[model samples]
Target: MVPRVPSPRRPRLPSGRAADAALAAVVLVLVAVGSLRSLIGERQESWETTALAWALLVAACAALYACRRHPVPTATFVLAATIAYYLVSAYDGPLLVAFVVALYTVAAEGRLRMAILLAALGLLLTGAGTLLGNHDVNGVALFMMTGWLVGVVALGWVRENRLALAREAEQRAASEERLRIARELHDVVGHHISLINVQSAAALRRLRKDPEGGPERAEEALGAIKDASREALRELRTTLGVLRQVDESAPTAPVAGLDRLGDLAAAARRTGLDVRVSTDGERRRLPAEVDLAAYRIVQESLTNVTRHAQATAVTVRTEHGPRHLTVEVTDNGRGPIPLGGGSGSGITGMRERARALGGELTTGPTLNGGFTVRATLPCPAAPLAHLPGPGSAMANGEPPRP
Candidate 1:
């Protein structure tokens, strides 16, 4: 069974406290004015009765200040005040608006069940008083009030759902970006570091075997190590630059693509591995995401060979079809091939990259005592007919030259 992960705690709305206070103040002023005007219609009532009704109205609207923080409690208080005001006053006023706002706040705070219970209780009491001839409100007014309360509850619930969905979307985007960064770091650092280790070890072995004669071979190994380290630093800086981007400015480093396969192969060859790259179909410019994915897959496959496969030679093949681009890395190594999609083998990450681009990746032992990683990536052919003629100073939506 899949384990349930709890949703993150909901963050407060922007300027939530200030906004809540402002809403309460506005409602209080409106309710006070409307209720005083309503009381003028019943001039025969005593001064004490008028004062009590006004107090209840103020209390109902004032309770809304804490509605967001204590939604259920505030809603209950507001409901009681509204009911008391209607019972004592000769006529109805806009005091019910305070109760409506309170009910909406309760539901918006994710207290749907509590809000519904309070609303039902208020409606029941109002209906009972009307039936007993204690309330001046008629049947039609009670029914209309019921409908308005129901709508307020529904609106609040909808707002809560929308906020929840937006939060989930943001979290998912952040998670995907983190995973992408990890894969880039693994490919960039892992390959070069493995090559450095191999070259350094070889140099040490040579010097131990023959002190004077081994110096020449050791020097060659050291040179390879220097090249590997330099390349690693360059790639590391590029990845870091992308990470440090805080605005919409252009990236400081260029993205790696298939055009750099020659350099990659040469680096692998320096570690005494015979690396060959072959292309079958006509190569064309690919989407940035597809190109990056293809490069990382090949880079990771070779890194696995250098670390696990005790092979002397490896072949990297690329086949560009009309709608898909295929990359295959094969090594004639006697070492064990990872049969499972484990994190250690980086097969999971590679598969994720392929799937992200609506593609698939497969890894298994080759027929002739070898291991191969094959990935097929979906790449739509660029439209050539829509291009501007050669004399145009821009291409692919780029700005024109000065």
Candidate 2:
């Protein structure tokens, strides 16, 4: 399951028109507050021109406020109003603020062609006052307009990338979990079913041959089948329980791993196959993830033997080294085609289990007339060794986090 991220709530009016209207009112108030000193001062220009300029600035801000929703149109309106204001009066305060905001929105939200067109219009209007009316060339005004416009657009793009990365991480985590669950289900069901099939067929043949003592022997086979089915279903339920609501108060059992290898070998022997397990070096506890993955790989390989190999004898060997643990499974039966010949579920599942723990697996027909599967799993010196005694929080893996 993917974890959710919380976002801050922003204020907005219900309808588009109302939202624009409310924004316009706030912009008007700000303009009035900022221009109060000059509004009641000695009239440098006629009241008619002054009132017209004020109206133009208000119009520019009202349009700028909707730049997020209507980028191209709002930018055009702001450009027209700014040029009109400068043409009518010499006074320039926060009047250019709206124009810059609108330009930024166009760069951030509009298509490339449209953004280029709006940018061209912005430059043309900056020189409009000089061309259409009396005004001096001002480099300061040009710099301020260009800088703010570029800055905010870059800011918006950065925000977009960060959000995308977060979503990608969530998806990767979910996909990995799904793969893991699938592997578990396959190993459990495949192993149980193969044993059941082998035992049931044997019982049927024994009954056909010997009329007496047939019921007693067949009863034993049925009992073994029932046990295998029950165990398989119980494990399936445990694996599926993770998808349900979890309660902290209810303790959960640990996953089966090397500790259950004896049970696995016993089940195989019950199917009349001679199975043997051999280990080397000192054996100790492994990280839960590594342990579970190793167990699944071995389990899948043996299940393949019971189903396809028809081998009378099977051998599993585990070797623990300083840096890695190796597992090998071999059976003396006529080998099937190599795993890569098709989408063989046993080989595919085994490979996935090893790779999930930053390890590798290989499978092929053994020269001695059978199939063999081998895998290697790395072992860290300690679980949290890289972490600074108590405070380090960075998660580690072979490849860096995306």
Candidate 3:
């Protein structure tokens, strides 16, 4: 199996408040020195008048520090200071900078509806004030205000859209987890329950024939039932452990691997099936997850044979390659054999396990009047690793054949 790529860490952004302090300091210098108007226009106003403008500009810019914590109130204070300076002062460099930043914060952090209403109200008030005072409204003033206001709102909208998409992705991941857990519960319990039913019916028939010998047969049936119950509970607890929040001191049970196949085959033999197992190449170790998946496929296949297939013989085979491994389980059963028919949920589950590892599974009725399940699982390695092609002979040097 290919190892999963680790997720990247989120990028860290510099604090906006740190930048705000610098911006506020720059605004203070420009307004106090009265040098801003030299670039925009000549500031012929007196030093006393410039000092008043400086006071209002400083108040507006200072409020920016609190915009994130109390966005609406801080923005309102900045707006009032801007209007006071706009109405009387000849310079507007610092006030304009503070005004745009405050509006963006209001939209980003606080109630959006209130921010929108305030923006519209300020626009109308500025237009009306300009008209009443007969100031020029068709020059650089109109274009600058329009661009600055619209840019702030657009940035806030983009941020909101990204947050919405992130929330939706988290919800979808949660739903998929629920479906996965449900499928695990079904597979673990369903096979054991099927075995229990078959054993119980046989015991009933024996009991109705002779009371003395019947007790012995019934005792055997109860023993099988107890074993099945314990197995189901153990597997359920092991699989469902992921859902618990509490930490555990007990060690987790190791997952079942291909090494347990001998015991599995022996169990099937007890259930009246003559089973055989064979390997085609060097039996090197597999990736942990791939080994577990192969074991489950073999176990499920044998359970299907006992529950559905009427035949008395079966075969389990494995072929190991340098870059991949193939597993097959075949039984002499009739076509469309219940859950083991190679077309129901059981086959779908097997295919899912293979596909998750970039592999595939195919199931069909063999020409020998039985059903066959075959799966190929991949193993990933570095680019430098040399592996033989599919048509090449095994490491044993035998000629390749289909």
TM-score list, all predictions: 0.86, 0.74, 0.62
What shift in Å separates residue 208 of candidate 2 from its native position after superposition?
5.4
What lDDT does the true structure give each of the candidates? 0.84, 0.73, 0.71
Stretches > 4 Å off in candidate 3: 1-144, 209-211, 250-253, 337-344, 381-402
| Residue 86 local lDDT, model 2 | 70
Worst 10 residues of 1 by lDDT: 389-398
- Which TM-score value belongs to model 2? 0.74
| Of 2 and 3, the candidate ranking higher by TM-score | 2
| Runs with alpha carbons beyond 4 Å of true place in candidate 1 | 1-14, 38-42, 247-254, 335-345, 383-402
Task: Give me the candidate number with maximum TM-score.
Answer: 1
How would you order the candidates by TM-score, starting with the best?
A: 1, 2, 3
Best-matching candidate per lDDT: 1
* Winner on lDDT (1 vs 3): 1
User: Taking the tens digit of each residue's C-alpha lDDT, what string does model 1 give over 265-329?
Assistant: 77788788988777766666789999889989988888888888989999888887889999999
Q: Residue by residue across 1-402, what tens digits does model 3's lDDT show?
A: 999999999977546777667656665665555536633456567777777766777788788777777788888888888888876676545456677777887777636776777677677777777678737454367667777787786677567667777888999888767756665666677667766776777678779987889989787776776776777787777776757856755545556676666656655665557788776665666788888788778877877777777768888888777788888999998744555435446666777778877888998898989999898999643332243421233321244578
Cα lDDT, model 1, residue 232: 90
Model 2 error, position 219 (Å): 2.6
